[model samples]
Target: MRNKSIKKLNNKMNSKKVIVTFLILVCTIFNIGAQNITPDSKVLYKKVNGDSLYLHLFKPEISKKPTAAIVFFFGGGWVGGNPKQFYQQSKYFASRGILAISAEYRVKNTHGTSPFECVEDGKSAIRWVRENAKELNIDPNKIVASGGSAGGHVALTTALIKGLENVDENLSVSSVPNAVVAYNPVSDTTLKGYGSKKVVGRETEISPTDQVKKDMPPMLIFHGTKDKTVPFENAERFTRLMKEAGNDCELVAVDNMGHGFFNGDFFRKGTGNKYFNLTAYKTDVFLEKLCYLKEKPTLAENIKQVSCIGDSNTEATYPKFLQEKLGENYQVKNFGKGGATLIEGTNHPYFKKKEYKNSLKFTPDIVLIMFGTNDANVKWCLDKTRKTKFIGTPQEEFKSQYIKLINTYKRKNENAEIYVLTPLPIYEHAKSRDPEIKKRIKHLYDWVIPIIREIAEEQNVKLIDVNKLMKKAYKYTVDGIHLNQKGYKILAKKIAKEIK
Candidate 1:
């Protein structure tokens, strides 16, 4: 009886031990998942209203020394807005090897403050970022100020306007960013533009467009043509003034779109993703151009990739030259198949090829599309039978198809920077191949190149004017249609200039 009691007690204790171990494992897993899902954030300042303003920080898992940083302010017309508005953008920049921050500032709803106070807080946040650059492991010189709508005004104020500095901030530390990315910003606060009533006494004090300076940071602005709250002309006027002042500013006007179109949440769930994705992708390209980011975008394990999609031209030697030019920092893959057309069900359709599938699988950070050479073939475009099978006119079909291709890659990787390449021009002699080839050359120059240019413009993706560049080097091509080694070298140089 004594031995039986002892064995029973031992079994009960062992059961308790197992239960405890399992519970501990479950808790550990949950904790790790929570950490991964939630980013690290901290309070940067405490206001007189007893509310703490926090900076939600998203630091890259892997970063090179002296990392670049981008700070975003939320838009709410100085009435109300949440730092969460830019969380997605911050997360994206963090993944690209930059320290990204979404800062909370004083707003009318919580602090009962005016736009001027908001501007002061904006400057303080930037100053804090600059002051703590060492602690944040970021390069102060590469800081980028970014925001949307009212918040965009704050961002611009950091660069263009002055005198709204916080008393506690170190005046020696500059709040101005090396670059700016603004979305539908209320750039003009005068009587003609947004927030005119709010800035009644001090119109020019907060008007970014009115304060354009010669040495302001390079800026990229995204605005909708149909925005009512902030007129589309505001963006145009601001960019024009910046350019006139000898500053670089790029304005991307989204057609038929309205206010707050840059934000995904502005539309119904899953509806406005395209606008958000394109804007984010363009910002990445702009940052890369400024040399703020490394040559290639940082992916998991520090790997970066570039996927080139096209026809014989991309397949021959350009990809190799690109690989050499990019050096060891990138995995350059040529997904080019010979005699491939951009259109589906065409002779040697590229969309149906394995290279296309491979390119999608690669999940590249940068995609270069150079198609249209084969699609412009006279037999493909002018054939009555083929034309009958096509979904629309050659130009319409081409535009829709190119947009489809861009959206496909964008869906695969929203961060990828897609570049559309114009088909290279054929030399005058190469046009003599046959009646069909001569007609193809004419179609390429007359119909195809213009169609691609229109698509690029409409889609708002960067266009590489390969036709224009190749025209200058047509002498390097042996047959006018295909480029020789010398021609490939020139092509590579131009591509490198654009991408690198």
Candidate 2:
């Protein structure tokens, strides 16, 4: 009776442990956020313990030469997680002209294995990719391993640990990845860190901190400072050890975020790209440094990209005619926010919008900037309650910001040709009854345009005096503020001459 009671007590304890593990692992994977992205193709990589494992490939449309590839492993505490967890990231890498893969690895609940097998499966997946590099049209030497949480541990073990090899496979092809990109990965797996109980006797053998050595592949890690599952200290320790051994390792500690903070959240769609897009951008920067992939899509050599930065005028007008005028040689992209200002303190600043980020991304060979018309919106520059003492003048901020905006573009691409255009003259604006435009129109004429000219001369950027060119063209404007098709065509001709 005593023996039976002891077994019953142990069984209850195991049941509760399973429940806790399930909750934590479920949050790590964030299965609900996984997108239904279909890979370009799926291939059977290996079979183990009567289960066949496959790889999800996100390949570019064309692979003329053997390009670099990145492989991703999903996190589930070595327990439960979907192969689709990294689909969003995989698709993005594919779009960037590289081969990307998300692998299926053994897990505790599904494969009836320990955490060690998860590491083994990660190695096997990389080995298979290397072995079939020619078939996949990827450079075998430049493979990158990436993952989050437990999957990150798996990825790191493939590069750090060597003993967990499958017996049947040929041992010649190296399984270690050329580089690593981890998102909140479990860097340590010993008694002092996470999953130590799961690994049991072989903790140090697979712990990345223990395996750090000289001349290892470069590593880039992103970890949330507030993560409890995988303590943030583990990341710090692993990086320190890596550098001590003369290896290159960088750790990006995300502030005040918890576990699974790197997962792609579909709900964060617009300007508030909390984590997903921001992390992806950082990931690309890391990969670009390692030569794994280019950060942006490759354009044909003959085509130069143009980024048009401005207000409602650039959005609704001249860009249409500018594209036609630039002809087949240039690809023009309009990044104009309707009510945006040069001054960031205003309610609608272009610097705070997604359009600004997108503008810098297209690899612009030429940048045309036009503002000042919208800075004339007197209300945007005001403090919440102007009834109180005046904070400062908008003109004071505009001069600095205009120079700052020009310098921003120059910093983005040193070789990029930048042009600063003056705002078109407002002869009579019927749609805009703003007291400033109707009354002192001098706000734009006297205060705004002169600042624009000063910015161009001070910054050494080329100047296009659009306000001077469109002086008497009021008949071609829709509301004397916005241009019609004919007005824009005339305006495009003037800008096109400067570009040529």
Candidate 3:
């Protein structure tokens, strides 16, 4: 009886071992799959004082070519911050078919450096990605610069500020990003803003607000209205200035929230996750607008190409904001030049320029024509010496040139849809800068605009009244002549609505 019991116990032990081994195999397979979905790789992007700054990359299981990328910087007031702060974001973007990276920069805690060094390292990280784009399967033009708080300032400076690049790095490789996503960024580092004292006399050089220009990339900023650290007014002011410079900037305001409200991992629990998720969702929407995501939030498919042609207002104007409003499916190109006119004998004729040829080459599905603003110039239009050279009056010549240009496009592509846009209204304040321009403005309002409308009717093409829209948002105009970023956005919305 004793021998039988001992054999039975050994059998039970053997059964338990088999079950344990099977469970271990299942868990191992699960873990492996998870790792394959989001795998981490590290590479040294910069080194300073014997310390190696590494970029922690998170790559997704891509089925096809992965062309989009996002590089994130962590925020800690430029004093101390860890790359882990953006680990969750990196993984999230990687899963969405983006090559996500969490970059390490010289911080006060580790490198004993200030904000200037941090900015330098940020630029280096972008250059590294752009330089190695082909090898990493990333689109150099589609790379996005994103960060939170002080790190947000670095990202903005990388795209805006001209100098302060790393001396040891490759200067040929540009560090500027195509777009920016900032969270509660210290964008205005002026005397009234945070980090001003830290940057010292270089405040204006480092401040993204102070560095605003006409051609900076589209930016999306998230800020809390109640936040005291960075203050909500800073974001408002920065975006205002950006628009004033004719650049696209979108601000998402979180009501009654404070600083550091966007960290998803920190707010993983409870209602805090709601705020984090909201920001992420909005970010996805913004990226989708830029055509960075493969699957958009909306159901539109089969992208359409759009070409915008005209003067300075058309150069970096509403097409950019239009691109954002139309989402990824509609590709918008700007073929505008400053001081370009429809009349051939003018100083800068639109038809004679290379942009016209390029626009024809694009063979776009939709064409937006916004001329007449510069054509109405007194020196170019009503000049006594040049006026008689044309077949008729300046207004009559404008109509004829516009009709010929329209016919040229229609003949080239019968299927192409052309939309004529009325020139934006010029404010008196802008006209005051040049007396001749002010006189020209009267001619535009009285003669040029009516003829444009008449031509649209005669050609049987769609007409967009941009002047009416700009009149409503006249406050967004910086110099009375050109629409600021906000005005462009408003105009773009009107154009986009017509297109849809």
Cα-based RMSD of the predictions, in order?
16.7, 13.7, 23.2
Instruction: State TM-scores per candidate.
Output: 0.53, 0.54, 0.52
lDDT of 3 by residue, 1-500 (tens): 12343344323323322122323222221111122223266766777789888888876444346468899999999999888767756766765667888899998887899888888899999998898775566889999999999989988988998887988878998999999999999888887789888888878878887889999999999999988999799899999999999999999998767887777423222111234445666777788789988664321223455889999998966887887787644557778888899986777888889889888765567899999888887777877576334677788889988998898889756878999999988767734565777787898889888998999999998898888756776687777788778778888988999998
lDDT of 1 by residue, 1-500 (tens): 12343343323322311122333222221111111234444545435457677777776654337788998999999999988777666766776678888889989898888999888888888887887776666898999999999999888888987788866657898978889999999999998899988878888888998899899999999999999999999899999999999999999998877887666422222222345556777888899999887664322112256788999899989987886676544556778999898766576887788888888866677899998888888777666577334577877777777888899999887878889999888755644454567677888888888988888888878899998877877677766678889789789888988987
Name the TM-score of candidate 1. 0.53
Candidate 3 runs further than 4 Å off:
1-39, 266-271, 297-500
| Highest TM-score model number | 2
Angstrom error of the Cα, residue 255, model 3: value is 0.9
How high is the CA lDDT of each candidate model? 0.76, 0.76, 0.77
